[model samples]
Target: MRDRPVPQLPLALILSFLAVSGLLLLEDLFARPFTFLTGISFEAVRRGEMALLLGLAALLAARFVRRDLIHGLLERRAGKALPHLIGDVASLFVLVVGAAIIMTGVYGWDIGAVVAAGGLSLAIVGLALKDVILAVFNGAALNVENAFMVGDRVKIGEVDGTVVQSTWRSTTILTKARRLVTIPNIALGTASITNFDRPDKSEQRVIEICLDYDVTAESAERILLAGVIGAAGISLVDAPRVHAIRLDRDGVVYAIRYVIANHDLGLSSDHAVIKSILAHLRDAGIGVSYPKQEVVTAERRIRVADRTVDRRVLVQQCELFRGLPPDVQARIAEALIEQKVQAGAALIAAGAVRSSLFIVGEGLMKRLRARPDRPGFVEERYVATQAFGRRAFLSDLPHPAPIGAVTQSLVFELTRAAFAGILAAHPEIKVPLATNLARSPTLDITHATEVSALEARAERPVAFYLSLLDAIASSEANAR
Candidate 1:
């Protein structure tokens, strides 16, 4: 005989019912009980059968209520408490507990002891993970506070990086060196942190300069203010100012300071402001100072020295003296005479009889246009040059343009006599006097004609006269 396949659930239910019915029938047949007791007329076997049917119905009801409805309710509650992993596990445990309760209560089995044991185990596990739970709490706090977001450059204690990821317990940061560093949330919360990108809407720009020691403090301040104001990318709200500070045995250090809008930082937009300041200083003939070092080959004590050059060679290289002939150049070179003026010396006064031209080779010279009675000089010009002076051989009436030096300058004197001699030799040298020249006479292109009458030439007399008038007008205009 071959074994039959196991019966299905429905078939098993039918078989169980039949077996119980048979047992009840045998119990009724073997032990006959009173059919009438307190006016009841049911057999003992029939009562037993009804009890068994009630038990089966209760089991089915308990399975639905405990395993399905109650389990689902507890699972939903646990799901809310655990967010990432713990919550899911808690939900599963709640579902398993509900199923156990249903099985024990409906089937008359004991499982309450097992439930107590499981609860004890869970308590022990929770105690061992106390630190992990605290970490989770810290992570939650970090997310809630939003102290720093992803891609934010933050410095915590000595660590600085861009926030890459944030979790409940830790954060990942990508450093400038392209390394990822993981840090605990609790540690980050306790450390000192700084964000470089803050204090929006305001920033400062600086231009460093080293001014010569001889420059007056007031003059340096005024020039710095002008330069900073004229520079680009400098905010108008923050006016420029200069700070003069002493250095170690060198000279005065000048800092041109101005503020810019913070949005312009690190964009190289504020560079133009610095560039403009430098250009302004250069245009005003203010030179940037460089370090000077002196070394003596053999000496008990080496003394610092200042070296000087002749101003004659300096003027030869100027653009103003270019294109002149060789002999004229020689005369101009030899005519340069050195003159010394004190610190407040007035070399030339406006409207005065302008005598020999003065060139500044060294030191400073000032030229003024205002009278002595004015509040200040109307025009003050400063000329500081290596070889700067007048060209030799010029008239006094039309004096060469006056220039002032601000330092000890080498000045060249060119008298009217020397200028006249050069002009007499170079007779072809003519100065431009006017824009318009005298008009030249028109050249008459016509000759006396024998057949002058238009009638003989078969031309209209009116047209011929008009053409002659137009030609005459054009010729006269050209001559003019």
Candidate 2:
């Protein structure tokens, strides 16, 4: 709103009115004194009064020309408010035309003589202030063409920044390095500008990464897309995407593309997206590939940790399986399958029976449980290494609520028969787990609670373990 016409309008009109009144009242008071002092007739200089009156009227017309003619009428037709310089130019034109009318029309002055004198004066002033005049007109032209506006991120020549101010003389910008830069309007008019801001439109940014030759392009692209799908400051609804751009010297180059809501958050948004990509790659045990030129004296090998290793680690860390034999647990870990869920996709559906258990490998899941009092649902979350579907797998109950992926995630699925097959093959495996469960005060579960006929004494914990496993296995089979 800087240089807008409203503030100066009233002041211009008030000054014009005061000038007209003062000239009329002071004419009689100074006319006799002028005749006595200088011996020049008052009638001769009275035409000067007419000239002054016309000049005051011209100034008033100039203000109206600036506000209503240029700003209100022309700008409305142009779709956006143009640079203030255009209004100034139009107002100056009005003032000059009003002067020409007062001089030639009223006095019948010699047109050729007046033109010669005015032309000489204009040439001298124009030469002295050539750059200033050009800059003003350049600013007007830039606005007429609908160039970048204030707060728009632009790259004018080598400078990349947001336009903080646009004046007739220059455009000032706040750079990414946190410095202010001023680009003269003359230079700006000639320079190529890249405007990153567009009306009602968001921009898509691409992040490029290289991976080693051993890694499949499909898997890398999948992981990269997963990382960006729900990254902070990205447009999730726009559908972030990935592509295998090309084959590089050491590996395949991938481009992950995502939409950004605003251009001003460039640094923070990129930081978040890059951080997420690194995290997913780290969790998957994949190392980022750099330009490889180093010659090895010995053939050095870099090993990527397998998903089987991740499954075993999750199994060993789980409280439910901690007391089981290490070998038996390893076998159960081997039965796990990799599962992937996209952001906002449903992992578990309400009223659906689940026959497999899920352990989060990376990222997050949100459980939407209906609130006791509210009309809508509330959220519960599960992160890396946490598992779900215990009740469904153990007791064959349909899911009470839906579980959705909060971010693109990796999960390990354990089929219903994963534990049951292991127990049937090695029945002795249940002994250690049952003994540990009976000894722990925090784990008060027993077969007696499940079936009143079964005596759940500590001396016979193996019988309880067998019963528990059998019931769980049967429930899972029925659900399947």
Candidate 3:
């Protein structure tokens, strides 16, 4: 980072002294020669020297006042730009006064006449540039009030953006779309302005979502809260909140409010929150409400299929069981046990031995992993036809993550014992199953080793059964 420049009194004094000396030297050299040629006389040269000396002295004095008094006082109390602005205005005032004094005292001009003429000229100029003058005053007011600063996100009338520049004439804003807008200071002063980064850069953002009436308000709130909390760049100090603010014709409206760490992250945070909410709702089998009107005139007929055929269809829909032969697929489908899990139920916990592969038959489930930094969970959504726990079931490893039901769900579980019995009775199926398992992205040999080590230290029956499954899978892989 660049270091701040410090004022040097000795340097200013030396420069001032050299300027005065140069003026005196010019007067001595030109006074006699000019008087002899032009008849203007030596007195005029002396007067010019004095006038120059007065102006130089005023400039030197202004410099000293700014560096020694004004700057020191304002630097700490006001912001970085305000101190410089005050100093510049002060210096200009001193220089203007010094010029007036030089015209009256040195050249012997009438003070009253000068003041009257100057006042009239100023009045005419001010009238011609009234808008400009108002802008200057408005800018000064903004600086004094500390209304907003560069990099602050602000809304002025219809324009909303971060302040890129603030000047006496106009303030420039860089919008979210990357468009630059310049608004006159006077207009900003007259219009209502909202500063999102005032006092603190942290800002609260609200995300409104409409959910069907089928979802209870309490359940919606829980889902919304779970989505926002622990989101990247969101403020954790303030707890995230959800409110069922309105019940409209289409559905109930929910507002999810959360704080972002900085105004700059507002857009990204909003996107993340909305994405999370959608994922959560989808995982919970909840649908957003939309206007729909339907009429039924005839009775509907329902058809029931064979249980084994339904199970086979559900298994085949999953990518994990896609390429298996018909006979093998049928045998696997026969081994699956249909299970129903209620909402908010844990299907699997992290670091626990998982002996079964679960495929979603209906409804939704979510995979959650414990956050290392805090006592919270990060979730991933799973819907119908999705399969989880493939790594643990295939490699005989402990689950490295947890799975839970976000809503009441129907699932089909194929346990290691059930599959092992099939594989033992017909060893030919082991090679193809092992080949599919080996191709799985979740398969990790290291994870299997870690699970084996953990199981060897425990006397759990599940662990012993997992060891037997691991031996069978290893034999199949070796045979290949």
Model 3 sits at a Cα RMSD from the real structure of 9.8
Best by TM-score: 2
Residue 473 lDDT (model 1): 39
Q: Tell me the RMSD of model 1 versus the true structure.
A: 23.9
Weakest lDDT window of 10 consecutive positions for candidate 3 = 300-309
User: Per-residue lDDT of 1-480 in model 3, one digit per residue for the tens?
Assistant: 112367766675568677767767776576677778888868887787788688778878788666656666555455443324456567778888898889888998988887788898999999999999998888878878888876678999999998877767888999989999999988977899899877788878888889877666655765677667524455544667789899888899998887766777778888887887776565455666767575646453221112223677666656667777777778888889977677679888888997788876654577764544457555555555567776677667899887777655667899876776666656665455555544544321112212333233322244443454567655555555
User: TM-score rank, highest first?
Assistant: 2, 3, 1
Off by over 4 Å in 1: 1-146, 151-153, 158-164, 172-183, 197-201, 205-208, 233-237, 267-270, 294-480
| Distance from true location, Cα of 77 in model 2, Å | 14
> How big is the positional error of residue 70 in model 2, measured in Å on the Cα after superposition?
7.8
C-alpha positional error of residue 69 in candidate 1 after TM-score superposition, expressed in Å: 29
Q: Name the regions of candidate 3 deviating beyond 4 angstroms.
A: 1-20, 26-28, 56-88, 104-113, 230-233, 293-480
Which model is ahead, 1 or 3, in terms of lDDT? 3
Name the best candidate (by lDDT).
Answer: 2
Question: Per-residue lDDT tens digits of candidate 1, residues 13-54?
Answer: 556667766666676653245343334445534654555645
* Decoy 3 TM-score against native: 0.58
